[model samples]
Target: MTTVTSRPASAASMAWAGRASGVWLRLSVTAALLAAAGNIYALSDLEGIYGRETSAFVNQAIAQDAVDLAVVSPAIAVLAFLARRGSLRAYLTWLGAVAFMTYNYVIYTLSVHVGPLFLVWVAVLGLSAFSLIGGLAALDGQAVAARFDRAPRRPAGWLLVIVAALFTMLWLKDIVPATLAGRLPQSVSELALPSSPVHVLDLSFFLPAAFISGALLLRGRPWAYTTAPGLLAFLALTGLPIMVTPFVAQTRGDEPAWAVLPPIVGIVIACLAVLAGLMRPLPRATGTPVKVPVSRTDRRHPPHQDAAA
Candidate 1:
């Protein structure tokens, strides 16, 4: 039987795996602070969007802001911590967090009217966009993949594909009919917004990434190992707030519980389940030996050959 041994990763690879760039770190810290401050201010002092005249979209935005303050703000801090350790997983997580922030701030910047926090939202949008590009560029896909074991890859891959497909169907279902009828989606009128930022961003970026990453993972491609976990984590973390938004609005009497509760609850359950699965430890590969050929002279006197020569 041929012996198979794992090749040890190079120092350079390990260094790259652990080292997050100073630029990314600084951007992440600044973004987190700004996000926290903006969300807090929105939750407490911002009333224009929360009053009786506010539309459904405005209420949803407020609720999402609450979630941002309570959940996503802290998540950015955690991403910073992970990145500081130079962890590949942490780096991926940071990327995901950036994606989530990018998506969130896009909605804020475009959909919401200009307000006290307008510039802050714009700053977040710009920072997140740059940070994401920087983070993705910095990562070594093969190095990141080497950090994880084989177990979770399949499940994570499938989950990502399923998520991508479902969201694609969900968005297109609304979009296609509206296009065919030459009418705006009801969400547009209800939210009183120019268009659906979620649809635009998801179709343009998020869903596509999900689908691509999922397909790669399913095929046992290296890129999947690098991208899928982060994508899944991003979706899960950001999605929690989305799932909670309707319930929050319902409690505030902005909308009926039945309208937003049931579907979101199911979504929440699915997201939580996948998040849990993804969080399971992916043990590093062990004892995967690669055969190195030994010449006859070396094999005959392995220990003394070099010294004798």
Candidate 2:
């Protein structure tokens, strides 16, 4: 009985791997550029670009500044991963990606609601974009077998969907009326909430994120990598806006209720993205097995080829 051995890697497999590596490299470069841009913008004294609260996070410890640290830390970690190998790099890259994404979401929300603050947006976008870039950069020469099995297998995914949808429906009930009421020029001081559709759609985007994050953690992705940024990002983008509206109105001596989702789900999605990255499958060894090498004399001397030997 002959045992079949695996064959060497094929041209197609090599080509695919090359392409994947290239993509990761490009992503890393993008992340680095964005991070640099963010740093520059943060330094600029542009009005409506930096909020007092947001500025604190960004400018904290200029040498050890949190925003700079958070954004750059991941890139460094990603670089380390690329220079090295094994699960450690994978873990670091994954965590960095999560942090970057979460930061991105928060900055995105603030920029949209508070003001342009394009600098903050650029910074956050850079963090996320760079994280992805860094992540891909580190993946250069690495082979990953992409898998479609990241989606949760249990009923929990579905259950959360239903619950989130309901919350969205409830949240919407409060929002639409408020939005309509607030639309009036005289409505500045009136308490109003978001529309139902907004709540539902927001929830729809949010819950999946939470579910993804949770799943990633359970599947053993790092906390920082799987959960932090996504949760923070979602909260900043979706949760904070609603909370801020009332404060904004109150600061102006008015009262208004802006709709906000609980954000339980958004947290999950961020976590999942990290986990999914870590758990990404390695390339399956495919192709027919080739026989192991044997001595030419042995092959020629075989019962079937005695004359040839």
Q: What is the C-alpha RMSD of each candidate to the true structure, in Å?
A: 9.2, 13.8
RMSD in Å for candidate 2, one decimal?
13.8
- Candidate 1 residue-wise lDDT, 97-213, digit = tens: 777888888888887777788899999888878887876766655544554434456677777788789889988998889979998877665776667888888899889999999
Each model's lDDT comes to: 0.66, 0.38
Off by over 4 Å in 2: 1-17, 36-48, 51-152, 155-174, 182-309
Q: Clash pairs of candidate 1?
A: 4-289, 5-288, 5-289, 5-290, 6-288, 6-289, 18-86
- Please write out the lDDT profile of model 2 over residues 60-129, one tens digit for every residue: 2122222443444355446434422223233333434444444444534442335444555555555555
Best by TM-score: 1
Q: Evaluated with lDDT, which candidate comes out highest?
A: 1
TM-score of predicted model 2?
0.38
In model 1, which runs have C-alpha deviations exceeding 4 angstroms? 1-19, 49-53, 257-279, 286-309
